[model samples]
Target: MKPQLLFSLLLASSLPAADAPVQIGSRRELFADSFLIESFSGTHLQLQTPRDEGVAFKFDQPWEGLFSGYATLVTLGDGRLRAYYRGKAVANKDGSEEELTCVAESADGRTWTKPELGIYEVIGTRKNNVVLMKAHTATHNFSPFRDQRPGVPEGERFKAFGGTMEGGGLTAWKSPDGLRWEKLAPEPVITKAMVPYKYMFDSQNVPFWSAAEGKYVAYYRVFEGGIRRIVRSESSDFRTWSAPVLMEYRHPSMQAPIEHLYTNQTHPYFRAPHLYVSIAARFMPGRRVLTDEQAAAIKVNPNYFKDTSDAIFMTTRPVEGTAHSGVYDRTFLEGFIRGGIGAQNWVSRTNYPALNVVPTGPHEMSVFVNQDYAQPTAHMRRYSLRTDGFASLHCSYAGGHAITKPVVFAGRELSLNFSTSAAGGVKVGFEDVDGKPVPGFGLEDCVMQIGNELDRKVAWKSGTDVSKLAGKPLRLRISMKDADVFSFQFMP
Candidate 1:
């Protein structure tokens, strides 16, 4: 389907309450949103933060110094990992002469090394790892992704967009092997003339070929009413785009406060391709934390210490056959990942996460973050999270239970990604839409789940098979005590 037509068919409001049962088929669903939830007795949705796994690599290279930022981690078809970021030694304008793009490579996502590409001469040396140089503002934020569109030619296997409003607008860039690059068109494809926002294209303007949408979707930056927000557009051929749409946020219960979102690192979750996860930078313009003594001790840039920043989590689903929701579900308004325990971490724009969260292991995924910004100690740090574990239906020791909305399934058994304390556990039961328990799948028949596992099949007193209940509209009650249910899906 065309992107414009897909976008036009989306619901005006993403979180509309309906009485009819929703069809989920066999796709995995996370508790990150309230779409499948009806009500809760004592449980709540908890936003999960990845565990810090220490430094992945540093910007200590000659070309990639303290000012190097806007990093992106891409996993290739052959399992090789590519890390790209800007390289600048000192603070300068967006399109400064010193600004250049560099790449680092890794077989496994944990260890990264910058290869001596010797592609472009920088700092009077040809042994550097520079990819592109002398590209004006485009180098400021060059974002790329591996295009997964069905018939996308091998020459266009990779795609990218980079530019600034001051430099005209976003220009299209493409590569065959992802090592060498070239512009798809000489002129900017998305310009100010197509949008109403005043300031746009300043941050990491991310674009990707969405498998669920079957079209190219671009989520970029824009300033409306002086607040740094996000705007989205779509294209079928990667050259022309649809009318700009300002993304709105919705919650199941309350309205969330609006803050400056510096960069919306929005992309489809690798496991659940239909759900888009955004580990965004929440910027507080003047929320200063460092004192003069602390700031000077760390040798942070004088201009950057005036404010602080951290990362936040948001999700956008392909609601009701629509490709892009054009709305984000703000389930938990708090920071998904907060600043660390040092004065250096409280500095301005220091905790901004990288563009994508790539898997480092079979059971582990990693989110790379730019840490210690504006200082000589600047580097990218790796944080680890369990697979499909972004948010969860959490319950404390006090114990609580939640019931899901009516949903029809197509599988034989249910499996979950969950964690629990030794003394606590989780249980699941099936019920009708009117709250009547199903035979052999009531609360009493559930076998308590104890310990942690990425995928554990739930069992009843009878067996783990639920194929008898397949194709029938029913509700699920998740009861827990000091446990977290990250995600659940039916298996055939």
Candidate 2:
């Protein structure tokens, strides 16, 4: 059945007398644009789920035990992947001597092995995977990122931010490789005095060079109305950051129930670097899932089993001149990764996500999570998702259609990452900003797009080339049946 089409879709049903086209600049944009999706008739935008790959690495070292936090993973140039997290056996106030930053490596993200760096001796052994220790309390949550900014010093190729305001705000560190570290500044780079908030910089404060904005971006935890929330700050250099502003959620999210976000695993998506994705842990304080008996069986910390939490996803396309204006789309308010099977999975802060999501294979990306925290079974588990598969414009067998706001572009071909059932298919049509279908590019001209593909070019009887439409404001009308369009990009 042909899906119904809407004309000049607006933020409302009644269109402005003569609405101006949404002037999408000549950069590659993604379907992640929630604002573009003005309306969907019988269609819905769906969030994709990550498949669990069990334990990627375990915190079984004698020195390491329950209470591991701030797991960070990075893919290296040497064809290896590195995992970093604090190794602690028992609960200690944030920066106790018990906390040691540990390292684990993997050739493939699946099987991980900890290499004995033997750099710092903790737990009476110089033969463990301890990377940073006794370096003040900063190692308690040392969050690191590969500094890919242009002209970054060889020794400073790796950068990190750690420590709380009580431990002296956040201190900067540099590493030639990710293993060894040195302080960028003797004093903390960002302090409580810099921001108006009193209790900021408490969790895994993450900072990375955003190639899109050409600045250093950091997402950290801050208290608001006594509830945990996320804030954003920026810097041209890693040493100094802009004042932290509470991140605001857009339309649907602003309307949804709020929860405490523990650690925001916010990072630039590898494919769409401009779109920052956050797989943040939604902490449900005092929301107990395990009874005392169940908690005792798992040997969870007495204080830990009282609450439970899981991961949620959000995205933002940061613009340069926004101070507390960046919008986060919590399109999916439900848990991205739910606690499965066991009561142990629901214990306090067990499913706190790591800092970054790394690509493990050509078609797949993996996110590491700190699971079973403060329990004897505490370890890191991996969740896998197809490339560009975080969210999709989805429809069921009943089928539906969506019309995008007018956008400008510069490309010869339109490519989509999508999947469908045998009977499901997708068809796309182009229209001028005025809501008039382009000649030879109407829905009737489209050849039904079927099958699953990472990059499939949309075509019509007029052929796929649309270079002539470059820079002209246009809209896309997509109709689908039992299919999901994960993402789309126009390529020159």
Candidate 3:
């Protein structure tokens, strides 16, 4: 053997054995540390900004004026997308009497239509899309989600929770079809008495059946030490929930500064059900962006211009067998969706995102935002990102590198969703679990991966065949220059 080839084989043989390969099935595993990662240089993890897709539909209806917000969008199993939001024409405290839960449907995420459900009579006309009406405080923030749990009752195919302290804590509602809703219980299902905090259920309290944890989970607003913070609770059945535990951020060394997260739209990423993504409204209290003159010119609600807010992205991985194991990563603390051009976009509680991100087209997914809040133009605007393109392992023109702790994956070929400038590129090399370079797949053997592609294959002189590494523990040492790797997976 050549001297270099002999040394390479010796190094590979001397490395310690790797831990068992993790069975990361073809789910859209994000680089959000859903798996362990280690050893990096010069690279920065970046959050991809969503491109504004313009007004999805204006909240121009008489019932849905300036105060319309707290939007929730869900994709039905039948391929239809449904949008539900609270509609109010005037500004008032949470759970105001004028608030009503409204619905809209879309064949494609673009081009929405509000069908007259005729389920509830409002303003002497039953021709509106109001699904739940006059339900005490429940309609003030009635956020609904399509129940996808196995063996869920046929009559309770859909579920929702909404109510305030005055109206009682959170109440449960069920519906067979998205249109008709009935209270699952007369009293509050999750009451204030059940939580450690004094106040609860005031904001957009969200709940969804967590398939990852095999139970129901909710992330609700609570005042902890006089700051607006979030707490999580779980339930075996929808009626009874566990006591709330304050959720803490476990960010990287570059921790995100403490701030008020008003509305936490925490839900599992549709493509990657195991990863919970929170598109929250980060409120900067007293951070005024508009002068009285500018606010008056835009005709915003009087009380809404004093503070500013924007949308942020966070994630948590609910570990099984551990109670309250949802650890939130706040590493990327920047705004995922910034307030747009005008004073209208930065008003208090504006730029709040809708619930789940749904597939809009073949290569894209969309997330809706409540924009222009408290202004005449207040409406849900649509924004989009490439599928599984939330955070990326990125490096600048100066170049950088990163490595995985140890991954045991099944599959023949490794696929990557990445992008790079014409002058920038990336290369991959495999290391034994003990950090020794594997033969034939060393950095020098890797072909320079150039261009931007969603599913590009990584090749080396030995070809792209990585079946030999299947079902075995290994590590990946990636080197890149001016490039971003959004996600990667071992494929058959």
Q: Of the candidates shown, which would achieve the greatest lDDT relative to the real structure?
A: 1
TM-score of each: 0.95, 0.93, 0.92
Worst 10 residues of 2 by lDDT: 1-10
Give all candidates' CA lDDT scores. 0.88, 0.82, 0.84
Q: What TM-score should be assigned to candidate 2?
A: 0.93
Cα RMSD to the true fold for all candidates: 2.8, 6.2, 8.4
Best-fitting candidate, scored by TM-score? 1
Encode model 1's per-residue lDDT on 274-337: one tens digit a residue: 8899999999999999999999999999988889999999999766644456888888788888
Compare candidates 1 and 3 on lDDT and give the better one. Answer: 1
Runs off by more than 4 Å, candidate 3: 1-26, 33-35
Q: By lDDT, rank the candidates, best first.
A: 1, 3, 2
Q: Give per-residue CA lDDT, model 2, range 1-492, as digits (tens).
A: 100111112112443333556555544455553756867898887877899899888899988888887888887888688989998887778888888889999988998888978787765778889888877778888999999999998999999998887887889999999889989999988888876665877788888989988889888887887888877788988987776666767655358566798888888887778788888999989887788899899888898888889999888876533333345787778889998788889898888888778888988888888898888888999999988777788899999999988777777888888899999999999898767998888888888999999889999998898788778878899999999998887887
Off by over 4 Å in 1: 1-10, 13-17, 321-324
Point out where model 2 deviates above 4 Å. 1-33, 320-325
- For candidate 1, the TM-score is 0.95
Distance from true location, Cα of 428 in model 1, Å: 1.7
Residue 415 in model 3: shift from native, Å? 1.5
Locate the minimum summed-lDDT window of 10 residues in model 1.
1-10
- Look at candidate 3 and tell me the lDDT of residue 353: 91
